[model samples]
Target: MHVRHWENSGGNIWDKYTVKMFPQEYRDIDKIYEQALLVSNYADNAIALAEKLEKAILSLEEQPYRGAERKYGFYAFKGYRQLTVENYIIIYEVFENEKVVAVVTVKYGKSEF
Candidate 1:
């Protein structure tokens, strides 16, 4: 989805990136919501957490490179970037040629896997 536009400091318009989520991204978030619901036993709190994660993921359209590069674990040096929201970490990559920000996956921050 094309979430927003981009403008530089000098008011120069830059190409906005299209944010695309992989199927795994959706499943990862759903898992988060389910786990949250299991723990808090509150649907509203779980929904709020999921919404916050979605908002963070959508914000990438404005600045795809804002996230920190993955420097550890399996994703290290793989051109992946990570955005942390609450207890979840979002992994994505930016394809400048395509002007697309592809959300690769989401994982619980505290999980070993």
Candidate 2:
């Protein structure tokens, strides 16, 4: 999906929001997907889950404000917002000036921040 953003560093309108997934998010996704594969003994399910998650994270591109303001969070999550997919929460921060969106972490609903 295409997401409109302010002019990029080179002042190009064609540029999309820079999506950066942090190391923690990577580890979280990997752990969850691997568990799914182990439980179901089906790689397809894990693959599908990963693809679905990627799509959810990308939704921040068009409207970063779409996420609700974070309350009662740690210092680093100060300006971050969350997007939920099923039981998973995608934590991210939007750098409007640079037109970048950083996906900080993906955690389960029951987990404490």
Candidate 2 C-alpha RMSD relative to the actual structure: 5.7
Candidate 2's C-alpha runs over 4 A off are: 1-15, 73-77
Clash number for each model: 0, 0
lDDT (Cα atoms) of all candidates against the true structure: 0.83, 0.74
Off by over 4 Å in 1: 1-14
**RMSD, model 1, all Cα superposed?**
3.7
lDDT of 1 by residue, 45-90 (tens): 9999999998887778777899999887777789999999998889
For every candidate in turn, the CA RMSD to the true structure comes to: 3.7, 5.7
lDDT of 1: 0.83
**Best model per TM-score:** 1
TM-scores for every candidate against the unseen true structure: 0.85, 0.75
Q: CA shift at 91, candidate 1, in angstroms?
A: 0.3
**100 in model 1: Cα distance from truth in Å?**
0.5
Global CA lDDT of candidate 2, please?
0.74
TM-score: model 1 vs. ground truth: 0.85
Which residue pairs collide in model 2, if any? none
